[model samples]
Target: MKAAPAAQQELLRLQALDTRLAQLAHRLNALPQTAPLAELATRDDAVRRSRAEAVGVLEDAKTELGRIESDVRIVEARIARDGERLTQTSSLKDVQALEGELVSLKRRLSDLEDQELVVMEKVEGAEGAVAAIDDERAAIAVAQQSLEAERDEASAGIATEREQTDRDRAVVAATIPADLLAFYEQRRVRGGGVGAALLRQRTCGGCTITLTGSDLEAVRRAAPDDVVQCPECDRILVRTDESGI
Candidate 1:
């Protein structure tokens, strides 16, 4: 392929713009807050799970408390009926039986009330646990929002730079001949974004391999307008005065 020396030099400028754009893309992806935001998401999920478990425990405790209260009500009703019967009965034996049942019913009510208190305590503890988890989730949400904002700000700055770089790349690319540009684009894809490299001293800048013997001799023989490729990496060689042919 043949391209003017000046055009070849423009290729390097185009490469610079492309490299800058790539760097900006990388910076956008690796914003400082991205990792922390990921961590915050994980923490938020855990807090949500804990809250769900705490709520389950709270509901169970409430149910148990309800059952105990119902049992106490039934026992109290039995005690009242038995006491009334003891007062109105004519037979002493009947009164004795009613009195004995009243005593048992009162004791059973006391036990039920005690059980209700323990369950109520459990409900309070479960509620506290849920509240703590909610607080943690809210904190995580705030942190995630902050990190996302920071990341978006950084990305916007990078996007601005990339836009300018794109304009610059278009200008430089327009200066390159169509066939030569196509050739460079192909090589750039193969070389991981480097299509052309400056040959400094005796080294192939693209692959950092020094040209020796026949490789160096061939480059020396090429015309000034000729587009020469690096033997090792196949990148177009853009020679300058500092190339040390």
Candidate 2:
């Protein structure tokens, strides 16, 4: 598992790139528009419900108004027939009965007209409620579109950065030995994305643990080409003059 000092240094560069790439991915996922987009989704649901309720109300009002109008037509037709009969009637008793019926029919008409007016008012109000809900939904839709555009724009920029970082990683990884690179990848997955660390000042950079007498002695005695592992974190120890033996 030995690699040249230069190759080990390349691993450090790779680690830096990996860290930056991870950060970029995190930033892409946690864009500022994400929260607002979520909020917009919730608001859209509420607006849809309100619009449905308003439509129901409007339909009911229209049906009621239609029924009232139908009743008014029937009553008006009856009144016209009775008025004609009154003019043609001959017997005094028949004429008196006809007049009485006419008076009752007119009162009925007045009551029906009043009910119709009330229903018409309800229809108007219901229509207005529906329109208001529609307007609110439209505004929300516009806002959502704007937020989505912003999110996409931010994502595009991050995507470009990630592309460049990935290219750099590929180039750096290519320079390392195949077996070493594969081993590094394995360790990186198991060790939280870090496979190699500098043994700086006798401390394992991976775990920040300073090697003691026996462990430190072993590392100091190891050949320059020997791959040293951090006893604390099990990561490859990249030795340098700054390692302080």
Candidate 3:
């Protein structure tokens, strides 16, 4: 523990480097997907929704058309039964009543047919929309396929980078002393994994506060190898070329 200040500084530096490398690796691992892949996923969802809405519209139109047809059939049946009753009647008043009923039934049938025509038109329009949606879905599928292929390539590149970084981390870890590593680890946990910071302009890297004039003078006077901790934040301050001592 009574080693030269230079040795202690090197230890702090090694620990800082290891911590930074680990953080970078963690970030690379947590990437969601390739950017293109994420974009394609969003488009895929929208296309599916559009297709579903189109299909739903067509289905509703079909149901309405069916109801109209059923009503027409019922009116026709009523007309037939009334006509049969008229044929069996001999009274003039009864025949006149039968004629009036027949006329009303015919009008009902006409109205039902007109309503059915309107629904058929709607069905045609809905079918057209469904066709449009189908085409859009097909295009989206093709685009998604292309995007997925590109994303796979990008992801593979990122994976390769991650492996290389991991190897670099192993190399760095092997060179670090255990006791110094433990110190760094404890400080990192306490400072939210920011155990080391590059000293610049007499300010503490961890807390971004300028040291008191006395503290700055004391640190400046220390040997180049001295591992200096910021009194305010207790973080190991690694002097860089930018440090305005």
After superposition on all C-alphas, the RMSD of every candidate to the true structure, in Å, is: 3.2, 3.3, 5.6
Model 3, position 197: C-alpha lDDT score:
70
lDDT of 1 by residue, 1-245 (tens): 78889999888898788778878888877888978888888878888888888899999988888888888888888888888888889998998888888888888888888888888899899889888888888888888888888888888878888888898889889988999999999999999989989899978778999999999999999999999999999999899987888
Candidate 2 lDDT (Cα, whole model)?
Answer: 0.89
lDDT of 3 by residue, 51-169 (tens): 78988999999999999899988989999998999999999999999899999999989999999999999999999988987787788778778766765665676677667767765
Model 1 segments more than 4 A misplaced: 1-7, 77-98, 170-186, 223-227, 240-242
Tell me the lDDT of model 1 at 88: 88
Q: Return the clash pairs for model 1, or none.
A: none
TM agreement with the true structure for every prediction = 0.78, 0.78, 0.62
Error of 2 at 105 (Å): 4.1
In candidate 2, residue 54 scores what lDDT? 94
lDDT of 1: 0.87
C-alpha lDDT values of all predictions: 0.87, 0.89, 0.76
Q: Which is the winner by TM-score between candidate 1 and candidate 2?
A: 1
By summed lDDT, which 10 consecutive residues of candidate 3 come out lowest?
A: 1-10
